[model samples]
Target: MKVSFTYDKKQVLQALRYHFLSRKEIRLMIILVNVFALGSAFLFYFKKILPLAFLVGSFLWFILMLSFWFFLPGMVYRRATTFKDHFIMTFDPDSFSVGNERGSRSYPWKAVSNFLETPHFFHLYFDSRSFFLVPKDSFSNSDEIYQMRHMLKEKIKN
Candidate 1:
C-alpha cells in the first residue's frame, strides 16, 4: 500500500528532533556563537590598557552571554517553527518513497529501523533519529491520524 502525506516545517522539525536536530540550524548557530565569542576575546585581548579584573570579567561576561544567546535562540527558534510545506513525502510498502524539496530515498520497509510518533507527527526512522515526519494535519481528522498512528505502532519500536 502507499501512503501519501504533506506537512509544514514545524511538524517536520518535531519529527526530526526525535533523532536529531536539523544540522543546518545547529551548525549555523554554532558558527554564529563561535564568531562572536572569538571576536569578543580578541577585543578584550587587544585592550591591553584594561585592568586584569576587567579582562577576566569581560571574558566571563562574554562566555555567559554566548552560552545564553546560543541556547535561548535555539529553544525559541525551535519552539516557534512554522508548519509550512517545504516538501512532500510518500511511502509505499514496497520500498518506494519520495519527499519533496529533497530528492528521494527508496528502500524497502525492511530497511526501516524504527519509528516514533509525537502528538502531531509520525516518524519513520530508517536510522536512529534520522526520520521523515508525516504531520497529523495531513489526515482528515484526529481520529484518522490516530488510527493510522495506531496501525503502525506495532511495526516499529526499533
Candidate 2:
C-alpha cells in the first residue's frame, strides 16, 4: 500500500504531544508531579506545611506541563524539516520506502522497533527516540486506512 502526505502544523504539534505523553517515563512523571502538587495543597490547607511548599510544588508542576505542551512541541516544529516536505510512502510485506523531492529511503520491516497510533498519525518508531510520523489523513479512504493499520500490526511488534 502507498500514500502521499504533508503535515499540518496543528496536527503535527498535537501528535508530538501524544508522542511525549505516550512514553512511560513521561506519563509517570506527570502523575508524580500532580500528586506532589496536590499533596502540597492539602498540607497547606491543613496548616501542616508552609504556603511556600504549596507554591513551589504548583510552580514546578506548571513548568513541567508548559514544557511538554509548548516548548517541546515548538522546538520539534522548528527542527523538523521533514514536516515541510511532501512525502510518498509505500509499504510492502517486507519493507517500506519513503520518498520526497530530495530522495527516497527504504527500510526492512525488521528495522522498525514498534509503532504507535495516535488520533491523527501513525508513529513508526525506528527506536525509542527516532521515528517517522505518517499522517492518517494521507490514506485515500477508510479502506486504505484499515489496510495500512492491518499491515503495520502484522509487520511490527508494537
Candidate 3:
C-alpha cells in the first residue's frame, strides 16, 4: 500500500511530545521530578521545609515540563527539514520505501526496530532516538490504516 502526505505542525508537535515522553530516561526523570515536587509540597505544608525550597522545586518541575512540551519539540521540528517536505511512502511485506522530490530511500523490514501508533501518526523507529512519522490522515480510509497497522505488526516486532 502507498500513501502521500505532509506533516501538520500541530499533529507533529504532539507526536514529538509523545516520542519524548515515551523514552525511558525522560519518563524516569519526569517521575522523579514529580516525586520531588510532591515531597516539597508536603514538607512545606508541615513547616518541615522552607518556602524557598518548595518554590525552587515547583520552578524546576515547571521548567522541565515546559521544555518537553514546547521547546524541545519545536526546536526539533524547525531544525529538521524532513518534516516540511511532501512525502510518498510505500509499504509491502518485504520492505518499505519513502521518497520526495529530492530523493527516495528504501529499507527492509529489519531496518525499523519498532513502531508506535499515536492518534495522528505512526512513528517508525529505527532505534531508540530516531524515527519517521507517517500521518494517519493520509490513508484513504480506516481499512487502509488497519492494513498498514497489521503489516507493520507483522514486519516489525515491538
Candidate 4:
C-alpha cells in the first residue's frame, strides 16, 4: 500500500485551480465583488458616505487582495519545498498504518474532519492550515484504488 510519486508543476497548478474555483464560481465571485465595489463607489459619489473613508476602505480591500495574491505563492512554494521533508500520507485499510509511510504517525481516520480527493492526491484535512497530501500513485491497480477510496470515505464520514 505504499508508493512514491512526484507532482510536476502542471499537475499541481491544475489541481489547485480545480479545487479553488470552478469556472462558474469564479465568474460569480468576480461579479459579486465588482457589484459591491460599484455600489460603494456610487454611494461615495452622492456624498452619502465620507469620501476619505470610502477611498481608504477601497484601498484597504485592494491591498488585502494583493496581499492574498502575494502570499499564495509563498504558501504553494512552502508546500512544494517541504512536501518531501514533511511526512505526507493517509491510513491504509489493509495495514491500519500510514498508507504512504509506515512507522511514522498512526492516525485514525476520524481525526480528519474531511478529505479532498484531487486528481493527484488525497488531501486529508486536519484543520485550517494543516493537511496531508497522499498521492494517488500509492495504489498500483484499480482494485487497490477502489478499496482505498472506499475505506477512506467510510472512515472520514465519522
Candidate 5:
C-alpha cells in the first residue's frame, strides 16, 4: 500500500508532544513536578511552608509545562526540514520506503524497532529518539489505515 501527504503544522506539533510525553523519563519528570507542586500547595495552605517556596514550586511546574507544550515542539518543528516536505511512503511485505523531493530511502521490517499510533499519525520509531510520522490523513480511507496498522504490528516488535 502507498500514501502521500504533507504534515500539518498544528497536528504535527501535537504529535510531537505525544511522542515526548510517551518517553518514560519525561513522563516521570512531569509526574514528579506535579507531585511537588501539589505538596507545596498543601504545605502553604497549612502554614507548613513559606509563600516563597510555594511560589517557586508553582513557577517550576509552569516552566516545565510551557517548555514541553510549546518551546520544545516549536524548536523541533523549526529544525527538522522533513516535516515541511511532501512525502510518498510505500509499504510492502518485506520493506517500506519513503521518498521526498530530495531523495528516497528504503528499509527492511527489522529497521523499525516499534511503532506508536496517535490520533493523527503512525509514529514509526527506529529507536528511542528517532521516528517518522505518517499522517493518517494521507490514506484513502479507514480501511487503508487499519491495514497499515495491522501491517506495522506484524512487521515490527514493540
Candidate 6:
C-alpha cells in the first residue's frame, strides 16, 4: 500500500503531544508533579504547611503542564523540517519506504522498534527519541489503516 501526505500544523502538534505523553518518563513526571501539588494543597488546607509551599507546588505544576502542552511541541515543530515537506510512503510485506523531494529511504521491518496510534498519525518509532509520523488521513480509508496496523503488529514485537 502507498499514500501521499503533508502535515497540518495543528495535527502535527497534537501528534507530538501524544507522542510525548506516551513516554513512560513523561507520564511519571506528570504524575509526580500532580501528586506533589495535591499534597501541598492538602497540607495547606489542614494548616500544616506554609502558604509558600502550596504556591510553589502550584507554580511547578502549571509550568510543567504548560511546557508539555505548548512549549515543547512548538520548539520541536519549528526545528523539524520533516513536517514541512510532502512525502510518499509505500509499505510492502517486509519493509517500507519514504520518499520526498530530497531523496528516498527504505528500511526493513526490523528497523522499527514499535508503532503508536494516535488520533491523527501512526508514530513509527526507531527508538524512544526518534520516529516517523504518518498521518492517518493519508490512507485511502479505514481498511487501509486497519491493514497497516495489523502489519505493524505482526512485524514489530514490542
lDDT of 1: 0.56
Cα-lDDT of candidate 6: 0.96
Q: What is the lDDT of residue 6 in candidate 5?
A: 96
lDDT agreement of model 2 with the native: 0.94
CA-lDDT, candidates in order: 0.56, 0.94, 0.96, 0.61, 0.96, 0.96
What TM-score would every model get versus the actual structure? 0.46, 0.97, 0.99, 0.56, 0.99, 0.98
| Model 5 Cα lDDT, one tens digit per residue, 60-136 | 99999999999999999999999989999989999999999999999999999989999999999999999999999
Task: Report the alpha-carbon TM-score of model 2 versus the true structure.
Answer: 0.97
Off by over 4 Å in 5: none
Q: Candidate 1 — which residues are off by over 4 angstroms?
A: 1-85, 101-103
Candidate 2 residue lDDT tens string, 1-158? 88998899999999999999988999999999999999999999999999999999999999999999999998999998988999999998899999999999999999999998898999999999999999999998989888888999998986
Question: RMSD, each candidate, Å?
Answer: 9.0, 0.8, 0.5, 5.9, 0.6, 0.7
Better of 1 and 4 by TM-score: 4
lDDT at residue 5 of model 1 (Cα atoms): 58
Query: Which candidate, 1 or 2, has the higher lDDT?
Result: 2
Better of 2 and 4 by lDDT: 2
Clashing pairs in 1: 8-83, 9-84, 19-129
lDDT of 3 by residue, 13-111 (tens): 999999999999999999999999999999999999999999999999999999999999999999999999999999888999999999999999999
Q: Write the per-residue lDDT of candidate 4 for residues 39-135, one digit (tens) a residue.
A: 7788999989878757765775576455444455446745775444434344465333442333456776667777778777776777644666666
**TM-score of model number 5:** 0.99
Error of 1 at 142 (Å): 3.3
